[model samples]
Target: MPLWCHASPAAAGAAHSEPALPLAGGNARVSPEVSAEQDEEGEGDGRRWSSLVPELLADILRRVDADAEKWPKRRDVAVCACVCRRWREVTIALVRPPLHCGRVTLLSSLKQPGPRDAPLQCFIKRNKKKSTFHLYLSLTQALIDEGKFLLAAHRNKCGFHMEYIISIRGDLSHGSHVGKIKSNFTRTKFTICDLQPQYEGSKVPSSSCRPRLASKQIKPLASTGNVETGKVSYEYNLLKSRGPRRIRCSIRCPIEEDTEIDPRKAKKPSTPGSLVLYNKLPQWHEHLQCWCLNFHGRVMVASVKNFQLIAPAGAGGPWGIQDDDAVILQFGKIEDDVFTMDYRQPLSAFQAFAICLSSFGSKLVCE
Candidate 1:
């Protein structure tokens, strides 16, 4: 069953109606009711509410923010933002990016760097028959069954090249797509492109704002233009060695300068940097006659797709990694159709998911 079907009607409605979170120069959409009320009430009522002491509003919002830290509950933070401009500002100010809090409270969190201390846990469900993939945020500490739906991607074959259109909607319609992953003729290399520009001040033309749910007023920010954010390439094994498959990634995204300091106080680099990730070499288990990489018991199956991504020495820039011992991103098979994907700083859920998608299908030349 689809994860969205598990969501409550109200939750599903909100998911379909709410505008994309403000990220990469996109603006938040004001709810129709709020806009209508404001127009009817005029600035007088707005000023009256805006007159509420800033300190008092902040105090109340801080309590609300602290109380609702996880999703379902985390929707409260976004709700607070939709109330008014003042509340929106306060909500955004109080909420920490996924890099700091390790929580994805808003849609924008999907684009921001992940947690530094720990890799954000997630799972991918593949519908082989349809050539579709769905990424979900594990709601529990351990991977079980249920999760919050994050992004969906469907594979499309165009002559020699293959493309994966990723969207917020499960249907994978063109209107809701945020980005895409395109591969070369041999499928040895793939380029990931964000539909929205990375830099601020860039404008998405009105024509690009196509709503999937036109009647419901759904306008996702992902409808913007394409911007190359990362690339993934597999190392060829001409000899077809018995070793595990090897892959490398180069991602362009913001890097956290200091995770030790308070996230609100820490300074972040304005420009995105190139983050490099290489698969950790697996050891040969002579008795089992197979190569293995420890997944801490999260992964039960051994397959070529199983990999642990780590930063090369000095490739960690602002990530603060002194050595390559830490696993930045790890994906392994947990079941026939299910897989575990865990990623940390310098990699967003979108980027992490795209990398895993590249592991799918057959790489004849690379193998």
Candidate 2:
């Protein structure tokens, strides 16, 4: 059965309320009550719709896909996918991945790499009382608070290091967790571990499996093992110079290879390659006496936590970059509880969110 069919009544109602079809002049809105009635009527006649010709169905879905290009409305595409198996197949074929489209229309997109040409704009909301952070895709504008929920993380102080557990669901439960970021006692060095290996033929590192083995909540999930996919280290300020913090990230990513080989004879895939990123240097404001980077108004507040990441010249092979100076990823403060995160190719939403989590606690030595 389709997942949508098994959803709760509240969820089904919410989905039904959104306009699935565009009228000749504009969108035709539907009330929840009316939509519910329509859904019942559709269900009774499911056989009629299921018999739609493949070509005609594909064309119809393509039109819907093009018409609803943004969220709320884009959800119409998902609605189409849930109607029947035929519609679902057509929708999947018509919808492009985040890497090519730059839009995250479904839950699966969260794990895929971002677009190569432009950065995917997103935001983070922090709950200080709960020590939880929610990542959202910016729906309307760059600084707007309204967004589509993506992933979430909860911070826990475990012994000497601080741990941020990243999950697809807001609850941050072990079952939903995709990965975690752990920091050292001083909060200067950190490691990112994926619950499952990201690349083909890659095995979980034994060293990365130790910490989770001690945790009751993570032990069962980590039985298959966890892999250390990346490391984030804040540069030490030996001189204690007064300026913004400096950070470098080394991410293990899949190396591109031809995909036409027969599976029966194919050998193990090549080991993943590393993609490195450096924090963009900010200029000193003589009058303000603070460091600044041009967020182009995306960021409103002055904060040491604000920084943009750029790939060094010629370090763009893994990211598919033609412009060496382009910002691969950028995060900044908008309000005390709100922040902006924009990231492009070579970094999945998971990697980008984990890197930003490292910026949370104080790094006295670097600050």
Candidate 3:
């Protein structure tokens, strides 16, 4: 278990522990770089692979693994290169594809000017036992914070674009912690029905998706006119290869105003309907107001630990909607990164599926 088992690296750092001493392996003699700067700038001898034999290369890879003492020998293919001259050449060939890890270097994206480790991410970096590991550098916001994305500011833009940055940083104080971490993806799944048409209707056209739309009252956010809508639904693949024995998921959707979603002619809603069938508006306007809270990091104050949507949506929309119609779900505790939840809606006698979204991935605990 990496140091994140209970206490933070900063917490561990405060304990006044001595730094680690290098213990290189094999008979190839420790690379002069070992003493140069742990992993900083080292005097590397760029030797050729043909000069070394295959068995020698394997042992060199092992030596690199042994030297790191913090990297996971199993998952990381990059560390093999550090083992010896030939193995380094071979490892380069394997990891070159995504040789680029950490952070979405897009100017439109911005990250909190601090460590961007997810709990799971934190868990992974701290577990690996190898040296010469990958870091979330080379992709920092400083790399891409220069481009202008007009589409990001528009709600009805033709193109679907969002600017987000995912960078990784190691707890240098603990070598084990750095090995436990890895790179991350750029986009995340988010859909707040009645929030943004683009969001509700923005579908990536994935076949692997298990069709989790609320079939009873709503169709999939994809088929309706919502195509290219800002609405987005992310279905994550919670894998064991990722870090942390458990992950804490948080979502915050804030509705700033009393909005209405008057589908011109929505079918019967979950709420008991007393809408006027003949003279009254055929489509009922469901007024709902919600608060959204976005959390960024750990919780240090008294606050909510989880949020559950009440009677979330099933089958909805693409119905006859009026101008005054809208829906809002506001988020709470945003600056804290806790991502707490808060919402309040009217007691109108209408019908619609309650929203169903959670931090847990769609495939989390399938029934």
Candidate 4:
């Protein structure tokens, strides 16, 4: 029997034993002693109220886990666990791999894969210019966080700050150099190049943004690059949107060296790698007055504050088709200004990060 259960019988006895003190009105009377015993029992009941059956509690926790996975950000689980001791124990037992098991504050916490089994946690702070962001990538789940100046970007002197140069570097002691990324902005397109070191010393022409071609001619665009290979690894292109605040994306490998020739064929032809496309553009919300990214055309949230990257359905075989729209990336807002990015395999930490960074700048120019 529970502690509250033992007190319940005593409370009933106390209520019966105490004599009623008659009042001046009629038959109504006050039983102070009985009331005191009942009050004590009520407090005990309050203490035991949360002692629900373990199986039922576990089921509730599973629902919470599912909801957390559905969220663009992973902090929902952390918030659920923080409710009370019972909830904390339940969540700790139910949450599985890839789910962060630490306390999250009102600061941006970027969770990516680390060298170790644990996921890397990165915090970001955008500079006042909206041109640069200070990043801190941690080795452990918590502790010893610092300012390493991981990345920065300078917007070209153009409307919308659409075109800019992004640089990713090592710490001050480690060389102070890594690579650069360039974004091409146009009337109907936006493109991000693979990171390359050669771009570090290249100067932007004073009239780079000036219109040089006739209205009907399309201008050629340069690709941005990274330092790891100094060559184009991947190219991400943003196509013209059909309507306001909407866009589509396509990603392809920079080099397509995979070629094969049959004995009867005259020459071997190279085929490009599979093309990855991002669509189902988010819509502008009338009530919120902001663009909302819809998950499965169901759950919707402000796009500027948070969004996700998911693989389109039907690519996988018949058995795997159900999970076609699975999430590949999750971005969420922690504070008013800070946000996080989490991505899965086939994408390097840098690559996943670059994709998220692409979402930061203005898109109205392309529309």
Best by TM-score: 1
Candidate 2 achieves a global lDDT of 0.74
Order of the predicted models by TM-score, top scorer first = 1, 2, 4, 3
Q: CA shift at 323, candidate 2, in angstroms?
A: 1.8
Q: Note the clash tally of each candidate.
A: 0, 0, 76, 8
Residue runs of model 1 more than 4 Å from their true location after superposition: 1-51, 197-223, 256-269
lDDT of each residue in 1-367, candidate 2, tens digit only: 1122212345334443443434222565322223455467765244445555667667677777788777767766767667556666666656776778877765556655788788899999999999999998888775965787788999999987899999878777656777899999889999999876234454444655444534444333244446888999998885768466889999886556322122222366534789888999998789987677888888998888898988889998755777877998899999999999999877889899999999998787886
lDDT of 1: 0.75
Q: Candidate 4: lDDT over CA atoms? A: 0.40
Task: Estimate the TM-score of every prediction.
Answer: 0.79, 0.77, 0.24, 0.39
Candidate number that wins on lDDT, 1 or 4: 1
Model 2: residues >4 Å from true position, as ranges? 1-50, 84-86, 197-225, 255-272
lDDT of candidate 3 over 56-138, digit per residue (tens): 55555455443432223212233233334455354433221100221111111111011112111110011123221111111
Candidate 4, poorest ten consecutive residues by summed lDDT: 105-114
By summed lDDT, which 10 consecutive residues of candidate 1 come out lowest? 23-32
CA RMSD per model (angstroms): 7.9, 6.8, 22.9, 22.4
Per-residue accuracy of model 4 over 259-292 as CA lDDT, tens digit each: 1111112155432233353433467689988566
Ranking by lDDT: 1, 2, 4, 3
